[model samples]
Target: MIRVAVFNFKMLPTRAFDRFSLQIAISGMSNQTDDEEVHVGPDGTFRPTPQQAEDLQLQLDEVEQELHQAAKYGLYLVEKNEELWQTIERLHVEHETAQTEWKGEMKTVERHLYAAQQERDAWRLCVIPLSLRIPLSSRKCHAVEDEVFQLQQSLTAAAAAQITMQMHRRGSELRRSPSSDFVGSRSVILQSPPSLDIDLDVLKQAVDDKDAQLRQALAREVDKDAYIKRLQQTKRDTLDIIQQMKTAAAMDVDVRRSMEARHAALVDRLSAVQMKLDESQDALQTRLEEESRLRDRIEDLQAELRSQGDDVDAQTSAIQSMRHKCARLEKELQAVSELAEAASTSATATDAFDRLESFFNLTALGIILEHQHRIAQEQLLEGSSRQTIARWFREAVASEVPYHAWHAWLTQRITGKPRRRFFAKGADVSPSSSLAKAIADFFDKYRHDKKSPKRSLESANPTPPYS
Candidate 1:
């Protein structure tokens, strides 16, 4: 209740007359007795006694002090309210400035995003057409796409570098002429024109250099062709030697000596080729190292450009567009290089495979010849007759050794046939021969007699089992 009364009192208007009236009323109430009687004056009108007048004066003084304090408080509150309004206005202005800056940044970001999307769509269009036109395997297609992505990265990095360099140069120029007219700066840019012309000249120069390099590479490829022809000749010679060795496996002269000599010559040629290949590899490594150094420098420039500010984004994008075209050309060049490398690798692999096949043929021929030679030696040691040997070889050839009973049949033929003999009875016979014949005849007659008795006994008691 007290708080409500205080609030209501604070709500009252701060007027001097109202404060005086309130003071008068308070003085009257304080002077009044419990019966509500009042002092009377001589003229019969109401008047204040000395105590009442003193009390009223004191109340008026207190009211005046309170009014003065309220007036100071109101003045302070007014100043504070004005300060708050000023603060509100300042905050509103800051918010608007911030919003404007944010909007500008968002617009810039949106433009960049839109441009990136467009570039992505353009790349897809290019790749889709290329992929559709070519009849490449999936692996090759993926490789092509990877190469494109790498080229894009390289081009973007190069563009970024070019933009960064240009921006630095522009900043320096601007700094040099802080008070130069805008028209004057524009005139200067038109006069020098550092961007496209310079890039074109550089590209042309690079193309000329690449043309020279390609010519050199072509010369190297010609040398490789010569080497490949030599290898082919060697292979043909080796095959011929193998055929000769097969035909004359049992010849008196040794064929391995000629083969060994040819193998040594092939090894020498291969060693030379290997040396050449190593030299080429070393050159490639050096070139790649140089390229890596250049790439590193480009990255450093890009990093510096990134540090400069956000203002170069549009210029960077324009540079990238130009570089994308350049990168397409680079892609074709890289494809050519890759094709050449692949051809070289395939040729090498083919050569190796051919050499390996030839070696295997030679090895198999040697094994067969050695086995035949060992068999001949064993037969000679066993003192096999010439006729027997001839028969064994004839039978081995006739058997054809396939489909059935090769081992058993060959073994039976290799063991000589059993011998049969006949004697002439009219010719004069030696005494010993006659005596042996008589003894043989007597034994034969005795054996016949013994068999007759046994036959009679069997006939008389024909076995019960037989019956």
Candidate 2:
């Protein structure tokens, strides 16, 4: 709420006036409506609300809180009676003054709006040439029509020229009519202008030259016949020389001389070889006794093998009769094999990943360790492939690594057919380092250290279930 500091308290209704006080009391005791409601009239003047009333819809509770806050700053001045009449008249005068001032501002805005509208109209007019296209279609049609008319004119001109030419040709043809008497025509042709007389000296010379050429032609034929015989003689001499050279080259004695030393050496070696062969026969005779004894043992073994074969046959028969049982067993074995293989593969992949991790870590550790290898030392410091210390990855290959079977398995995994050339592929991957290390580790772990081991691959125990 706002009020003038030097309020005209003299204009206020009498404070002690019991009649007005009673009226305020009566309203306060009764309905006791808002002061604005009670004082509102054409002649009344009221103070503004303490808070600036914003247009936003806030909760009543927040509005009240705001109002309470606003009330703390100042209180509204209340009044009644003719004093409000004078204030109301003054407010009306002020409102008129504000309206007049606003009208002036609105006129300025209107001036700007009118200018802007004019500018917009000018811009639209300027853009008319762009958006409001005068279609090329009508102009194009006119141009095409003109072109066609011009072409027709050209055609007419060309036809006229042709007809004129034809008329001239027809007139000439009529003048050149060949329907004349023969003697008269001959006489006219002979008596024509001197221009018709062509020179005959060149023709007379040409006839004499032809007669001379006929004589020369006879002489040339005789010369050609003689030359052909001489050419045949020369050709025969050339062929004779070529044949003699070929015969001499075929009987070349140099090749025999080249083999002479080798043939002598062969003769000497043959005698020595014969003596050695005699000694070899003697040794073979002694070995034959040993072989005979071995043959007896082999016979006994063959007998045993035959017995075993019979047993095996019986077993085979039994297995054949129990076809379903064998099939089930085989399937179970196959399933077990597949499961084992899958597990092995998973374990291998895991182990490989683990090894790779460990390998990198160990590599890092080794970098921290003393430097012995050149590559490793370089790789450690550099971090970059050029700078980073690296040894062959195979250096840390485990002794327990399996090579052959794993190679076979890997081959099976990579290619549907089992490739025995994995060693070659491995060689290609890292021949000097990883390949050697892997091969070493695989051999040490999977193969028996003995010279020989009598165990089939399938019979061997499975790898443990760990990476």
Candidate 3:
């Protein structure tokens, strides 16, 4: 039995059973079966004693316990492997989700970056023209200011000459009929040159009055010049900011766009203001010319009055005509004054009809409307057939369409709807109806006529019935 147990131990897998434990079991079995060796033959075949059998059984039980312990350990390993595999699968799923989220986030970032780039490009484009226009506009404004200054100087000179002439007339009248108070006071000194003393006093008073008036006019002109200079300076500062933005490499799109819009608005306002100034200058020039003509006529009449001193009827008629001319000039001056006041009071009212009462009186409105209609007709006729122009003008007037609306209609008729740039709004220079009306009025009143080449529009055109 001991030999059989040893043989079984040898036959057991070395990898599954401990060699040391197996040796011990075999040795113990051998010790028990030592006495049983008497049954052994020389060929090694033998039977065991009862004690040897018990020892063999005990070794078998010990081997079985070790085998059961190894199987339990293997089962524990298999369960741990299954847990590891589950963990790996869960980690893989998490990694895939993370990758998908990263891709989506990247796409969103790319889309936003593309939009920002496009907006930046649009602002850069808008800024380029504004930068270029600033210096040119400033130069033009300076030139206009120079012209206005020259016109003012000439007006002052003319006024001075007129005052001198008036003084001369007053002196002559004083010499012809001295004041009773002067005669009574200087009766004794009247022996040699009675009129000389009175003439001196009258001339002195006239000169002082004229000088005061001239000073006041000059002061007003200076104030106006200063105001204009201030406006120009502000405009220059705005342009400088725009230029700086243009030079910069990058800027916020919303800020750039707002600045661009503000610049455009400023340009439009400046242009309108320039137009008003030009019109005002022209009106001033016309008034000066008319004053010159009137002065010459007055001088001629004075000479005639001296020569025909006894012809009261002709002199009265001449005086009446002069009075009428003076009244007309005064009316024109009042109109000019009103226009200037309107312009100075508000920068927003660059277009006509913004303040209807400020621009057009009850008497002037109809004639202004007629003149506007004529201008519209002329403009239309220049490009299209006369029949079409006439028809359109007539229809516009009949419908009581505002000038801006009519201009838009005419523009649409001539050209298709105005094209806009990518990411840009409508055309910048589209004329307003009120602006058209204002422009027509300005031209009608100030533009020189083809006929009577030497005459101004105010002189060449027939006076309106209301006037």
Worst 10 residues of 1 by lDDT: 458-467
Report every candidate's CA lDDT.
0.48, 0.42, 0.50
Listed per candidate, the RMSD to the true structure in angstroms reads 51.5, 39.5, 53.1
Task: Rank by lDDT, highest first.
Answer: 3, 1, 2
Better by TM-score, candidate 3 or 2: 3
TM-score of 3: 0.23
lDDT of 2 at 439: 33
Query: Measured by TM-score, how close is model 1 to the native structure?
Result: 0.23
In model 2, what lDDT does residue 8 have? 29
Which has the better lDDT: candidate 1, or candidate 3? Answer: 3
The model with the greater lDDT, 1 or 2, is 1
Off by over 4 Å in 3: 1-44, 128-467
What are the runs in model 1 whose C-alpha is more than 4 Å off? 1-31, 34-44, 127-467
- Per-residue lDDT of 130-151 in model 1, one digit per residue for the tens? 3333334345445645655565
Q: Among all windows of ten consecutive residues in candidate 2, which has the lowest summed lDDT?
A: 365-374
Give lDDT for model 1.
0.48
lDDT, model 3, position 47: 38
lDDT of 3 at 404: 32
Tens-digit lDDT track for model 3 on 238-290? 79998888767355766789899999999999999899889767755654564
